[model samples]
Target: MTHEITDELQGIKVLVTGGAGFIGSNLCEFLLNNNAIVHCLDNFATGHRENISSFLNHPNFTLFTGDIRNLTDCKNAVSSMDYVLHQAALGSVPRSINDPITTNEVNVSGFLNMLTATRDEGVKRFVYAASSSTYGDSTTLPKEEDIIGKPLSPYAITKYVNELYANIFHKVYGVDTIGLRYFNVFGRKQDPNGAYAAVIPKFVKQLIDHQSPVINGDGSFSRDFTYIDNVIEMNVKAMLSIHPDAANNVYNVAYGERTTLIELLGILKEELAQYDTAIKDIEIQFGPERVGDVPHSLASIDKAKSLLGYAPVFDIKKGLQASVDWYWEHLK
Candidate 1:
């Protein structure tokens, strides 16, 4: 669903970093549909060309093949933009654990470069893709913005650093900034064939192939699996929000509910079974629990709703059905 002020985005100049990846591509499409001049800066390091191929020729869409780790690239991308949606970063806790140096360079150093550029360029607002991983070891049932535990992974550390930098930029440099702490977001363009692919898309692909999907632990661990549309709505609102308290703050972007892995797997089977009945018969295998993984994650969206007028339209079941439909058509 479109935000109330989405029409305000018309004629707006916006830059979406990592705009060729799943979430960033979705943002690029939505912003373009609303008549925004969208510049996409992605290194193609993790993002795919196929994701933005449909929009490559859109009159309002411009693609800049660049890396955020490079200061010059970051400055060029943010130049003359009304708003900056910084979504570029190295994700995956396991990947970070394996290679902390690269993660820090991309997530932390790159983030600082973007912040510095946005501040210097005088972009109206800077909204970024923060992670729920920043919540880290906290056992809080519904994660609030202020309550956070020590980071459990290098990736979490990097994301947290982003929030700190954003806050500092606003305080020290008068930069308008907002950080969206995204939970486990999933949707159509999400890659399902990577070593560090999100669990939902990855599992759906395995089940579609009639292979058993592996679950770490006993499948009791859960997360606040956010949908892409919800995320888009949040981004738009954060970019356009005029509420005094909305800027220079962090907000949790989630569905405000939790779903266990077992429950998620069950729903996936049911949705995919409509297209291929054999998916229901595929067994689920259990493996050792992943390191740097928390047992459960739930978000408190009260802050976003009150501050940015944020409302999530799609819940898990509906979102899963939509995702399954896309994957079934594309993957088959």
Candidate 2:
């Protein structure tokens, strides 16, 4: 899945905020594999030390134990970096709903701190993890970049604010930026034990443990579940994009397809069944719908394709199989 811009990443200094979390850790690994000098900044508020332990001793990797809320830490992390992959944010709508103040402090105020620090450091470009939740109350299928609705949760509000801040930073200070509105991303290293754990990993863990997984609704809710490799490709492309029109823009990073929750669970069960046939018999429980959850989500990746020559190589099934294999080895 290496892009044509692979040569540009070699020996480049890259900072990955939240570099100990799922997506962040994966980004760090990809960048390091491509011979980038990787600096990972994390406070471990949500990220796990074990997630990054394997790479701590890597010659090309440096770990910065710091919180994004502190301007000093943000400044320290951004200093002397060729690019900033800002993935540090308090995710999950329910988590935000439970503690909007903390979410705002980290996702909004912390984001501002990173922006200022990156601007001050004279980084080449700032590529960040945005969210499909930014689509908010919009009912449109295959969500386009230009059309968005009111944010239904504090988390969404913070992500939307990030886009605003990035735009202003680019316009006011000439700091190049790109925001990737990630769809429901799932893959290896995604935490499966947290209250805010995503569906794929959470259910995989439950099924592995022989526990019946619970669904929030009737299991018809769908999302454009994106894989980690696809996301890494987008980050790389965004960092290397030389097109005049690509800078300071937001693009949907997804596979351009959707899957219902029931179908998702079926796939998970089937995949896990390959390891333990009993997984096929596990029943699923239903719960009340979660607050701030959208009924369905799909993204249009055309903007990324046109602007950055992005082509996602993994769909849900392939990604799920890879994830299942990783969990089978790691979870045991």
Candidate 3:
């Protein structure tokens, strides 16, 4: 999993805010593998300890039990870090809808705390996990960075606000920031049991249990499903990018392709059937379309490609196969 971009991380002090969660833990692992000094800050709200248990004893790895909402906690974790990967936001549109107040407290106020800490600490670069949900109701294909419609959910509004805060932080405080808008990332260690679990892992868990996975609509809704590896690569690139115009810019982190739910289910079943033949016979159930879900999603990765030299090594099929193998081996 080592890439040329990771070479810049050798000996660098990096802090991952939600290092016990899926994407955050993966980033911590990648940083450690590349010989970076990794410090993780997490409170275990939505994160699991087992995700980072294997790295707890690593010489360069340190874990700090803290929440992002606390300014002192953020400052303490970021004290000596050279780079900050801010991933400690409350995710899920449904969760935000159910509890918009908490979502705002964490995603907005907490993000401000982290950004302020990064600036005060003089971190060289701040890279945070922005979301594709920020695209909102924009009916454009191959979504470009600059154009976005009104946010359709509290979660989306929070993410969009993050971009605004990052831009303002750079202009006002002179903090170097890069925002990577991830598109439906899925991979190993992604929790499959939660109510807000991502579609790929949720459906994989259902199929593994011989339970019919339900589609939210007629299965026509599509998404630009990004792999965790691709996301890690982009994060590294953003952290290390020296392009004169790269700072304070947000880039789309995706494979630049889309797959509908029906098509996704078909591929998932085929991939799982290799281990369990019975999975192929399991049917899909259709339900009402989820509110706040866009009809389609696709990304124009040209900005990242040109500025950060991002080249995604895994497409949806390859990513799904890898995810299915992990889920079968670990969950089954």
Candidate 4:
């Protein structure tokens, strides 16, 4: 099994906030696949309803169409769950730059609601989604867990604030918290046509539709570009394990490898050219660098590997190929 959910999490009660988005939906599927009674809460602000439509009928699954920014909603959702996976938040650097207030409301205030709810509810473990953008201006090559710079965007500030709040909960309320700093995760069921869609799916969609995919900057900036399976592993490990030293810590969930934009476009073209050879001829356009964008990002997974026993399964090429195949089948 490419993503066999371990029995450690089986039979556990889980509340996955933002359960309709790319990573949240995948986590919901993995939990159900492993026999956990799962509850999903989403407001459909950035997440799509169609993403979890297939799981609506599962006996072990409960879908609550709600927002995390509301304390009552987060409190009601967290009351019965043994573990909480907080994945909901507004994403995208430019979107956050344009609308920092909404981003703050959703990502910052919304995170605090979840934190307060989970702590008060006496949940066994709380694992939330953090972002690599927390490494705002460090100029470091492969980001480590302990060392971090200031935030670059409003979105980044929200994610960094997640860590801060989690730490406070752990210290003040004795709520066990863990943060997975995800770096460029992409795979199946990702929304391709959204205003804030991620790069892999967005690029693949344009390439398939015979549209030029715009590369911001000179196409030389790079990222770790982790896959969904690896991210799922990190979450499961963080939730299921009972390591004394690992609690109240943050770890980067990413492939330890780096790939440039030009290399990524080449790979996307190579994969998509199989179905539509004309994709090979689709010219890639360049644009000036966007605000609040990092020039490069890579992760050092030693912390995750040693502590939570985290092991990532796919690299950029394999992950992008899987993404391309999935989008081709589902987006048609």
Candidate 5:
């Protein structure tokens, strides 16, 4: 799927919260490349300076080092911006479970701050990063946007609350908003060294180092592992979309296919073998299932397709191959 760069995006000022993190940093780079004046706001709590270091000197890029929890900072960042891409939030389920108060402060309270700032600033569109975890406890194979079940974890609850808030803000305050419930997004610049690191990046790093990767369960669990570029495309589409039904709504951002954990590991090993044959011989370990983990997850992206014209360009195999190549060259 090819995304056309529109002239309206050029010279437009946009604020990307969490702009130093994985998906947010990718958005910043893509927007800057399209001649957009990009302002990056991050607290560096989970985001890193290294991710934005390369583009720090770009003439169109500006970095605002501040926490979203502070209303003043949120107002400062949202000022004079045409659009707000709110991506700053505590991400991991385990982290949120262990520290619910801090998670609520950042994800819930900080989100409220951004929404208030955006409304006051009269931003054109407020696009945010929602999560697939919001579909917790649902046994549906291909989860749809409207069929979400009760949230199973603190992180899930926070994200679901974001959807509710975005809807209220749109109806009462007339703040135009869109939410993209992202699936398991992974790719280049994604940190693979943290305790809450995503499975794909962590496994890729371990494979590169010829170390064993421990699967959380019996390897039967599956996910609609989305690629970063596909996610970037959705955000851009959401920003540019002017369709009446596109605003004040949520859409699933994913590849729309499921891959089991065992399948994922096999593909990773196959792709990494091109760099070093020995990587294929690395042992795999099994561990107990993680708490708050759902057995399977898949997304129905028909809404995004029909409303925003979203078309994911990479499938699991293609995306995994690209990600593996990136880790091999960068981490090896």
Candidate 6:
């Protein structure tokens, strides 16, 4: 039914929670483009209707506008799926800090509901969005799958809990799953507006509008900002993979290159300048370091690479180009 990974998901019924968000929307599109039937669930808390409006009429697509924090919604969404890509958690470190309780409800409790449903349904494999934040306070560069540090914020703890619960589910309930520790992902369908918007899109929007973008903490802190296409590829591979050694494991999904935020801003400005050189005038304001944020985050993707045969198609430069062009087209 699907195109690219038809060999893996032909006739498979998949459930993608938070399917209306940026990453989820792209994932839904990828699945439909490949021929898999996708059931998308989102409360529109952060997702936009226009994101999935294009697919409402598709025969293979179904929409459930419900909060993942609601256990009933989680149960209903996973009822008839072969694989569950649980991507519905509340994001943003700032957002979590603002309302850690709400973040806990959606990210932790909501995640357990999905995991329970996955176990109850006995799905072949469940793959969910793990975050680079799980690396937490680790001083090590190029974070590996096994090494980790104490979580700095509620959001980090929640994502880290996803892995913990998944492991427990495997040992206690025999539910096999995969957790993808996504690095900073940016691309098309990413929202550029709102208080909690990601760095790339937010900065791109500001530059497009000739507004000065804020650089948190001198921008010396860098991250392994991954592209959306790479994240999508990892999800696809995770679902299709039948590797015995890869099941119930967490893999870092990234391009393995560290770029500072200052450097990232330069690229965003340069890329936006392609459409309008006036963007070059966009200045940056350095502010106090954000609370509950890591100084740097870079992932060692060898686990995903050697096992899942994952090969990233875009690095930061190419990724920023795609993301900038997309925002310029849609938001601007």
lDDT per prediction? 0.94, 0.94, 0.94, 0.91, 0.93, 0.89
Tell me model 6's lDDT, rounded to 2 decimals. 0.89
In the range 217-288, model 1's lDDT, one tens digit per residue, is 999999999999999999999999999888999999999989999999999999999998988889999999
Candidate 4, lDDT over the whole model? 0.91
Residue 248's lDDT within candidate 4 is 90
Give the per-residue lDDT of model 6 (tens digit) for 13-63. 999999999999999988988789999999999988898989899999999
Q: Which residue ranges in model 2 land beyond 4 Å of their true spot? A: 1-6
Q: Each model's RMSD to truth, in Å?
A: 1.0, 1.1, 0.9, 1.0, 1.1, 1.7
Candidate 5 Cα deviation (angstroms), residue 203: 0.3
* Backbone clashes under 3 angstroms, per model: 0, 0, 0, 0, 0, 4
Write candidate 5's Cα lDDT for 243-266 as tens digits. Answer: 888898899999999999999999
Task: Mark the 10 consecutive residues where model 2 has the least summed lDDT.
Answer: 1-10
Kindly list the per-residue Cα lDDT of model 3 for residues 1-332, writing each as its tens digit.
53654557789999999999999999999999889999999999999999999999999999999999999999999999999999998999999999999999999999999999999999999999999999898998889999999999999999999999999999999999999999999999999988899899999999999999999999999999999999999999899889998889999999999999999999999999999999999989999988888899999999999999999999999999999999999997
Q: For model 2, how does the per-residue alpha-carbon lDDT over 54-92 read when each residue is reduced to its tens digit?
A: 889999999999999999999988889999999999999
lDDT of 2 at 142: 83
Task: Quote each prediction's TM-score.
Answer: 0.98, 0.98, 0.99, 0.98, 0.98, 0.97
Deviation in Å, model 4, residue 265 alpha carbon = 0.5
Model 6 TM-score is 0.97
Rate residue 53 of model 2 by lDDT.
86
